[model samples]
Target: MLSIAITGANSGIGLRAAQALATAGHHVLALCRDPDRGRAALADINAHATHPAGLIEADLSIPDSIKAAADQITHTVGHLDVLINNAAVFDQTVREPRFTADGHELFWATNHLGPFLLTAHLSPLLAAADRPRVINVASKGLLSMPRIRIRFDQLDDPSWYTPTRAYYHAKLAQVMTTLSLAEKAEGHLETTCVRVPAVRLDPDRVAAMPRLLRTLYAPKNRMAVPAERLGETYARLATRAGSLPGPYVDENLRPVRAPASAYDRAARERLWSLSQTATGDPAWAW
Candidate 1:
C-alpha cells in the first residue's frame, strides 16, 4: 500500500480521493485545517475504509500552519510516498478581496502560495522516499482565466479577474507554479496537476457556489461530473505509472495544455521567488 498524504482531504474532491486511496489498501493521511471538521469528514470515509487513515491539522491560508502540518507528517509518520496539493478556496462571500492572517491575498495564499511552501518544506522526505509523487489539484477553469504576465509589478493583485478572476488566477498560478517547481526540482520528485473538468457534488456549499446564480437554490448542472469522478482522476494520477507527468490532465486522464501562460518558465521562477518571500522560507537549494 502507498503511504499517501493529501491536503483538503476533509471534503469535496480531496475527501473522495483520500477515501478511494484508503479503500484501496493504502495508508492515507488527510490534512485538514480543523480537526473537528476533519473528523466529521473522515467518519464517512473510515466507515467504508479498507485501511484507516490519520488526520493532520492545517490551514493553508496561513503558511506556518502548513509548516506545522508538515512537521507532524514528516517526524511523526516516518515517510511520505505521495503528497497531494489539493486544498483550494473559491466563494462568493470572499469576493471583496480578503487577506489571510499572514496578510496574503486569500485566493493566492490558499490556491498557490500555500501549496508552494508546503511542498517546498517536504522536499527532503519526498526525495528520500523510494518513489515520490506530488499531485496538485488544479482546474481546467484556468482556461477561463486571463493571461498571467507574472511581472514584478503585478503579482500583488491576483485581483485582475474581477468577480472571480482572483480565484481563477490562483488556479492558474497553481499550474504554472507546479510546472516550474517540477523543473526546478528536476531529478528529486515528480510533480503533476490534474485539471478538473467540472464537478457537481453538493453544489450549494459556499466553496462550490459561483458568483452569479440564476435561481436562489437550483443546482446548475446535474450532468456535471461528481466529486467522486474528480477524485478518480486524482487517484489515477497518484497510482498510475508516468502516464501523465508535468502536464495538465483532462477528464479522460490525458495530457492537455491548459493555457500558454501555464508554460512560462520565467514567470514560474518569479512566482517561486515571490512565494519564498510569502511563505517566509529560504530559497530552494535543490
Candidate 2:
C-alpha cells in the first residue's frame, strides 16, 4: 500500500481525501495543527476506515511547527509515496495584510510557503519512493486577480490586503510554484496542480443562512463542495492514471492553462527564491 502524507487533514478537502484514502486501504498520515482535532479526526476516520491511520500535529501557518512535523514524519513514516499540499486559510472576508510569527504574508505563509517548506524538507522521503507524486490543491481564482506579482518586499512590508486578493494570491502561487517545482525536478518526480472550483461546506456557516440563499450563493458549505467533490482527483494523482507531470488540471482531471500570467518563468523563479528565503530551506535538488 502507498504511504501518503496529507496536510490540513482535520477538515474540509483534506479530511475527505483522507477518508477516501483510508477506505481504499492506503496508510494515511493525517497532519493537523490541533492535537485534539487531529485525534478526533483520526478516530472518525479509523472507526470504519479500510486502512490504519496516524496523526501528526503541525500548524501550517507556523514555520517552526512545520519543521517539527516534517522531522516527525521523517522519523516515523520513513518515506511517503504521495505528498498532498492540502492545508489552507481563507478565514477573512476583507483585504487584510497579515503575517505569521515568521513574518510571512498570512495567506502566502499557510497556502504557499508552508507547503513549499514541507515539500523541501520532505522531498528526500518522497524521492525515495518508486514513483512519487506531489499534488497541490489550486483554484480557478487565479483568473480573477488582474494584479498578481510576488513582491519580495511584501514579506517586508505587506501593504493593504483583502480577503479576495489574499485567497486568490495564495492559490495562484501554488499553481505557479508547482509548475516551477516540476521544471526543477526535470520529470524526476511527478508533480501536478489541480485547479478546483470555488465552493463552501461549513455547518455553522450554512445553517445560519437561508436554504435558498445557501443554494444560490455559496452552494458548497463551511467547506466548498464542487471544489472538493473532485478530492478523488488528488487520490488519482497517486493511485490512478492521473500521474501526468507538470500540468495544471481542472475539475474533470483535464489539463488547463490557469492564466497567461501564471506561465511567467521569471516570476516563478523570483517566487522560488523568495520562498527559499522565507522558509530557510533551499529548494530541493533533482
Candidate 3:
C-alpha cells in the first residue's frame, strides 16, 4: 500500500479523501492544524479504514509549524509516496485582507507558499519512494477569469484585495508551480494540479449560514458536486498506477487545458524563484 499524506484533512475534501484512502488500505497521514480537530478526524477516519490512520498537527500558514509537522512526519512515516497539498483558506465572508505574522497576505501565504514549502521540506522522503507524486490543487472557477495573471508586484498589496480575487490568484500560482515542478523534476517525480469544480458544502455548515446568505447560496449549493465524489478523485490521483492524463486534469482524471498564463515559461520560472525566496529556499530533492 502507498504511504500518503494529505493536508487540511480534518474536514471537507481532505477529510473525505483521507477516509477513502485509508479504506483502500493505504497508510494515510491526515495533517491538520488543530490538535483537537485532528484527533476527532482521526477517530472518524480510523472507524472506516482498513489501515489505521495517523495525524500530524500543522498550521500551514506558519513556516515554523509546517517545518515541525514535516519533522514529525519524517519520524512517523519514514517515507511518503504521495503528498497532497489540499489545505486552503477561501472564506468569502472575509472583507479586509489579513496578513500573517510574516507580513504576507493570508490567502497567498496559506494557499500557495505553505504547500510550496511543504513539498520542498518533504522532497527527500518523496524521492525515496518508488513513484513519488505531488498533487497540487486548482479551481475550475478560474475558467471564468480567462485573462487573470499573477500580480507579482502587488501580491500582498491590500489596495486590490478581495476574497474571490485573492483565492483565485493563489490557485493560479498553484497551477503555474505545478507545471514548473513537473518540468524541473526531470523524471525524478510526478506533479499534477487537479482543477476542482464547485464542491457541495456540508449540510451543517450551510444551515449555520445567515438566512440571506443561505438564500443567496442555495442555488449554487444545489448545483455543486458532492464532496465525496471529489474526494474519490483525490484518492485515485494518489493511488492510480501508470501515467496521468496531463499536468492539469478535471475531477474525472481527464485532461483539462490550463490557462494561457500557466504556459508562459518565463512567468513560471519567475514564480518558482519568488516562491523559493518566500519559503526560505528549502533544498529540493529534484
Top candidate (lDDT): 3
Residue range 104-138, candidate 2, lDDT tens digits: 77787888888998899889888888888899988
Top candidate on TM-score is 3
Q: Name the runs in model 1 displaced over 4 angstroms.
A: 158-163, 203-219, 242-246, 283-285
Order the candidate numbers by lDDT, best to worst.
Answer: 3, 2, 1
**lDDT (Cα atoms) of all candidates against the true structure:** 0.76, 0.78, 0.93
Residue 225 lDDT in candidate 1: 81
**Candidate 3 lDDT tens digits, 1-286:** 9999999999889999999999989999999998998999899999979989989989989999999989999998878899999999988778899999988999999999999999999999999999999999999999999999999899899999999999999999999999999899998888899999999987877887788888999999999999999999999999988877789999999999999999999999999999999889899988
Candidate 2: residue 146 Cα off by (Å) = 5.1
lDDT of 1 at 238: 82
Residue pairs clashing in model 1 are 33-58, 161-165
Candidate 2 lDDT (Cα, 0 to 1): 0.78
The digit string of per-residue lDDT tens for model 1 on 1-286 reads: 7888899998888999998988888888899987988999789778777778888898988877888888888875666778999988776556477777877778777888888888877777777777788888777666765565454565556545354676677777777777876787776777777888667756446345554652433554565688898888778888876545546777677778767777767777877777788788644536
Give the Å shift of residue 204 in candidate 3: 3.3
- Model 2 regions lying over 4 Å from their true place: 93-95, 204-228, 283-285
